[model samples]
Target: MNYFIFGGSGFIGTHLVNLLKEKYPDGNIYNLDIRENNHDGKSKYINCDVKQPINLNIVVDQNDIIFNFAAVHTTPGHPNHEYFETNIYGAENVTAFAEKFGIKKILFTSSIAPYGASEEMKSEETLPTPNTPYGISKLVAEKIHMIWQAKKDTERQLTIVRPGVVFGKGENGNFTRLYWGIKKHRFFYPGRKDTIKASIYVKELVNFMLYRIEMDRSDVEIYNCTYEPAFTIEEISDAMMKATDMKRTIYKIPGGVLKFAAGIIGALGGKSFGIHPDRVKKLMISTNISGKKLKESDYQFQYSFEEALKDWYNDNDNLYLE
Candidate 1:
């Protein structure tokens, strides 16, 4: 089967491409992104923007599957409008391309952000209350896919995966920062100990998606993807530190302290000390999403937080400890 991946240069996309190569050695996989594929050599790279009209020149078979991962998802980085423009427009263009090419299957990676930052555990049945532009835009993108599926009602297969804070080898954001802080033995609990930090190992996430696609289930299936038995911030830090064989002092600074500092910075027009008020606020809440649908599926997750940490810590490339 042919596989076409939009936003194939990003972290998840890169890993998915590798998985595709391993699973379908003879299949032709195309990676379409605004930027060129910088690492993986298995998949062919095509310079195409998902926000623009799809180019007809890129060959695709009707039996091929298209996975859409393009989005502007850096919560605090881009302006609000950028999220809607990239995510919504990108989904539209990709779905249009699929329709025009007679492709019947689409797999999308949406975010748990749609549920917003809540302390309660959310499931697929939960109604979305997306407050931020990134969250709102992702929910809209999911709707766009559903509309396309509805148009093709009986013929199309759509799998919408709402993944939580995916982390692994190429991830250099949140997980990496935490790793560094722990490595230096200065990591502290930023908020309450019970704050849930739902997440998935990138490899496991890609594996589960492939498992679903290979099953060739008809119609639409939506899943909230995260590792089972969500871990608290305290638990995560402990597991990561233990897995890495790091003996560090875990300190807890009351949530109020961070909030107060954030307030002072906001009032004085001073720059945030790597901790914005919004981020500090989020640290106190739990994004405990339920993966009931995925858990019920036939595929078993291969990596837990401990296993994922072991993989990364052992990989010299990933551990950039001085």
Candidate 2:
């Protein structure tokens, strides 16, 4: 088997690549990314930008299964245009290549961000109301995949996965920011501390993707990839504080006060605050998503939030803390 994974240099991508190599030792895996991956010789890394169309025929054959995981992702203070260009354009390019080569299966790694922040748990059936440009772009990309799948012949299959916040080694997103901040004794909780944040560990998400691909269903499917259990902001903060042995204060400022301060900081060109406005919004709002469909599909979480956090801390102990 030959597997092509875009964004293989990223946190989730690297973990997925490692898993694939171990699971299919005899198979060949090709990584397409803008930067070269630092993995061992088991996988081949190709430097390619997904935003631009590439002649994938040289690398990808009809027998190959392509996983489109490339994106600008969610970043604080990033321009909206960058997200659209990379995410939307990248999806278009990947689908174009897949259709041209008649690839049997193409798995798109999308985000739970498309469902947006909601006090109520969002399920697969919920209509998407994307709040951020990153989310909007991801939602649009999913639509593109659906459109292509509908128009394609009977040979191709498209699976769309809207995963919650994915965390693992080398991840520098909201998870890493909170983890390292707490580890370095710079932790702070904004607004209410009990907001539940939907998230999934990288290993579990990859496992689900591989499982679905093995099933080889013909219909286009969308699944919300997340853990059975959810974590509250307070719980995560407490866990990190305990793990790092930090005694730093956890402030519980009123939500309105924080929002006002954020508005002022935004007006001041984000110079007043060290963190970006988007990050602030994430901390304040609830992005909880449901994993009922994944659970109903008989997928179980391999690791608990506590276990994953411990692994993260142990692996990154020397690099960030020392």
Candidate 3:
């Protein structure tokens, strides 16, 4: 059976592709993405964009699985239309491709953004109140996938995972920024220490994905992908400090003071001064999510937050030492 991965060049996709290669070395792997492969040349790379109808003359097998991870996810980085253009249209195109090939199984990596900036711990059953364009787009994409699954309910399999901030090797996002912050001794608490930042290590994230794929469930199963009893910013920072034993003075600045400085910098056409207005605003919002269904499942959490940090830290000292 072949594996088709959309956005396989991205952070999560790259790691997922690695896992696939190790597990199914002989299986045909196809990566359809706008970017180049982030791994050694092992899989078939197709320069395809999902914003439009995909024209793949590939030898798609009946048992092949499709993983749709394509989307514009950067909140402060993307224009409003870009999210819809990539996420909404990409969903339609991917589902169409799956239908075209009669592929019955699909796993989608959605975000906890759909739950909005809520401080309350939410589960899969929680009603979504997505305020951002990115969140709205993902919520709509979920429905698009659901509609596809509904059409062939008996035969098809669909699994959806809504993960929080996923971090690990090759991830140059939030955790990377945090690493830099701590290393440079510039990391400071953003007004609130208790802000819940629900997150998971990328390796652990993919492990859960594989768990769902191997499960006997069929047709419409959605689970939030986060460590239950999420960590506060202070807690996360402390874990990092202990993991690396880095000596850095950390303190909290008044929210109003930082917000005011951010406004001036933002108005001056500056993205940020390590204090973007948008980033600062996002700092206080909590992502206290509950992976209730996952907790109730037979799958166990193999990697603790501390273990993840230590693994990531030792994986590359260059990232921290630099």
Runs of candidate 1 with Cα error greater than 4 angstroms are: 260-274, 317-322
Backbone clashes, each candidate: 0, 0, 0
lDDT of each: 0.83, 0.79, 0.85
Which portions of model 2 miss their true places by more than 4 Å? 57-59, 242-249, 256-274, 317-322
Q: Lowest-lDDT window of 10 residues in candidate 2?
A: 270-279
lDDT of 3 by residue, 165-230 (tens): 898888877777777777767567778889988899898888888877766556799988888778
Q: Candidate 1 at 27: error in angstroms?
A: 1.7
What is the full ranking by lDDT, best candidate first? 3, 1, 2
Query: Quick one: ranking by TM-score, best first?
Result: 3, 1, 2
Summarize candidate 2's per-residue lDDT along 17-77 as a digit string, tens digits.
8889899988888889998984777678888899999675465577788889999975665
- Model 2's alpha-carbon lDDT is 0.79
Single out the weakest 10-residue window by summed lDDT for candidate 3: 313-322
1 or 2, greater by lDDT: 1
